[model samples]
Target: MKQVVAVTSKAQLEAFIDFPHDLYENDPCYVPELFIAQRDLLTPGKHPFHDHSPVQLFLAYDNGKVAGRIAAIFNKNHNAFNNTTDGFFGFFDCVNDKEISSMLFSKAEQWLKEQGATSIVGPANFSTNETCGLLVKGFDTPPFAMMPYNKAYYESLIGNVGLHKKVDLIAYRFGEDGYDDKSVRLKEAIVNRLKTKGIVIRPVVKKNFQAEVDKIREVYNSAWDRNLGFVPMTHKEFDYLAKDLKMILDTDFCLVAEKDGKLVGFALAIPDINQILINIRRGRLLPFGLFKLLFGMKKINGIRVIALGVVEGYRKLGIEACLYASIIEAYRKKKYKHCEASWILEHNELMNKALEHVKGVPHKRYRIFEKAI
Candidate 1:
């Protein structure tokens, strides 16, 4: 017999977090998320998102063995922002059995319907602002930092539940030797041109990070407003995320463009810590896990250009190219081998073209799915 149980106890919650470790045990490409981080993120008071939204975690068991897990999320902010009754399912993992997959979806759908939700959308662990989407097209390589990955069959399982494609997010790769020096020369001219307007690009200052972050928050909220599934992050939420990123933020790769003392653009890149995390063993940091993380930092060879934003008023001023050029320049100086600029909207031609201008090649793709209740 199969049964779906609400994760109401600590032991069950731990099991929920540990399920993926076993599910992907033999999959060489699987990179486990850190256990402690996952616990804190899902905990009510630990993450700021819980302050405004409600989430329920579930574990699916069959014949007394764990079969799957899912999170039923009721995003109050998303509903209020978009003025629609929508729910989300995230942190999803399952065995190959169709029955177990169906049971998990049924439990999530039931919970959302009880909350008066009219549609269910995701694979989003929390939201688009967080890690969302399923690896539908790219499975040969491990995922980049903060990206999602799953077995290819998981795509069929999701489709079996009637969740069709909502959108596809793209990831592009750039090799250290691949960028066109012509583009670099053009970017120099662009930077000089912008300087005439009192606009200059500089690295993020660690000492005055709070002020920089405040400016970034303003630009981030406004820049991505029109993206599909984007919901502006609250002040607290942005601050919370910024604090976490600051721990691994490399100043060389984190740059900002300012014009007349007003922040108009920013780009953030982080060392590809997945190179270290892959060895962390189910994302644990205790009992030798911390040693791997601490020592492995020095060996990381790649970067993930996770965010790049330019304000609406500042578009076409070459700020975007400058940000890309700066990152590439830093990567060259640091002797990094490659970088990934990721989770770009498939339809975002402007940004896509900007990446191609720097010789970025499309390497991986992810998809978000939605279905009417």
Candidate 2:
């Protein structure tokens, strides 16, 4: 018989985290997440996300064999910031059976209803601040570091369940001969003009990394405030994120714009460690897996332009273009083959145009879906 159960015990939670590895075992494109990192992110007391939000994990089984898993989320911060009673479903992976799919959604919907949620939305692991979204297109390649990827049938499964698209997210690729260096040629002029206004762009200083993180957190929260599904991250949450990103961050690609010593904007890109991660079996780092991770950095050929934002007053002054140019200059100098600038909202005209100006093309699409509870 088919069955679905709450992941309540240590063993069950392990099952929840490992199911995808087995599910995608034969798929060449599947990239296993680090088992330990996922464990902490899902465990309540271990991550700062748990300090304010509640999440539950569920697993579906067929004759005791794990068939699928999902996380139900009720983000108090998201609701408070957006002023709505919204619930979310995330970490979703399932087999192709309609009955099993319906069973999983029913269980999640039942739990969300009890929490007073008026709508259920996502594929968000916890929130958009994390890896969220259902891959509706672009399954030909492995995901960039920190981006979501899933079976193509996922879209059908979700649509069959009455969920409708909430929004689409775009990922752009700058391939060989694809980068337009017009901005780089014009960067000096832009910087000179901005300097006349007391603004300058520079790389982040490693000595004051903590202080820099604090400043960037302010810019991050303010710059993306008007974005859909946005909520201001708490100090603890921002710190947690900064520490995690620091591991793969290249200081040169992390640029900041300042006006008289205060940050007004920033851009962050990291080496696509997925190049190495994809080779590490089952996302483990022990018993020779550690060697691969330690020796793999030199082989990575791409970078992910994960974030680029400017505070309100800093926009439209060519800061965004200059940030793109700075990163492109570094990318070329490092001899990286390509870069992926991702998760831009489909309607975000300013960002879309800025990226396109440098010959970036949308190479993938991810979607968030919602259903009334």
Candidate 3:
């Protein structure tokens, strides 16, 4: 017999977080998310997302064993910003059984509907601002830091539940020796040209990080407003996310473009920490997990240029290329071998072209699914 149970107790919640560890135990590509981080993210009052929104966790049980888990999320800010009644499902994990997957989706749909959501979209662990999407392609390699990954069959399970594809997000990889130095030189010239117009590109100022973050948040929210599946992040939501990223943020890779003291563009790249987390064992940092993380930092070889945006007015002035050029140059100087610039919308031709121009090959893809309830 199969039963779906809302996770209301600590034990159930722990099961919810730990299910993936067991499910992907034998999969070499699987990287377990840190247990402590997952717990805090899901726990109300512990994470700021709970201050304005609601998320309900559920577990699917088959007789005495846990079969799956899901989180039914209602992002008040997302709905309000987009002016729609769309709910989200995230932190999804399930066994190979279609019956169990269906049960988990049913619970999520019912709860979302009760919250007045007319449609459900995701696998978004929280939001697009955070790690989201299912790896629909490129299963041969492990996922980069903060990226999502799952067995290929999970896509079929999601489709079986009638969730249709919303959009495909792409990840492009650039090898250290593969970047076009001519392109870099050209972009450097353009960057210098922009400088003559009083436009300056500089590393994020650590001393004024909060103020800088505030400005960057404005650009982030506004720049991505028209993107597929994008929802403006509320102040609280953005700050919550920024706080977490700050811990892993490499100042050198976090660059901002300012014109006349107004922030117009930004690019952020994060160290690929999955190499360390892979050894952390189910995302634990207890006794020795901390040692792995602390010592592993210096050895990371890959980077992910996760966020890059140029505000509307500032577009087409070589700002985007400059951001890319700067990061690629930094990677070269640091002896990093490769980087992934990812999750770009399929329809974003300009950004895609910029990457292709710089020799970033499209290597991985992810998709978001949606269903009208």
Estimate the TM-score of every prediction: 0.98, 0.98, 0.97
The sequence of per-residue lDDT tens digits that candidate 2 reaches over residues 182-301 is 989999999999999999999998889899999999999999998999889999999999998887778989999999888999999999999998888888889878899878988899
Off by over 4 Å in 3: none
lDDT computed for candidate 2: 0.91
lDDT tens readout by residue for model 1, 1-373: 8999999998998999999999999787889998988998999999899999999999999999999999999999888888889999999999998899999999999999999898999989899999999998878889989999898899899999999999999999988797666646788799899999999999989999999999999989888887887888988899999998898889999999998888999999999989988888878888999999888888999999999999998988889878878887888888999789997999999888877876889999999999999
Off by over 4 Å in 2: none
lDDT of 3 by residue, 1-373 (tens): 8999999999998899999999999788999999988898999988878888899999999988998989999998888878889999998888889999999999999999999999999989788878899889999989998899998999999999999999899999888788766646888689789999899999998889889989999999888988876777777777877887888888889999999999999999999999899888877899899999989999999999889998998898988878877887788889998789887888889888877887879999999999999
User: How many clashing residue pairs appear in each of the predictions shown?
Assistant: 2, 0, 2
Tell me, by TM-score, which candidate is best.
2
Better of 2 and 3 by lDDT: 2
Worst 10 residues of 2 by lDDT: 350-359
Q: What is the C-alpha local distance difference test score of each model?
A: 0.90, 0.91, 0.89
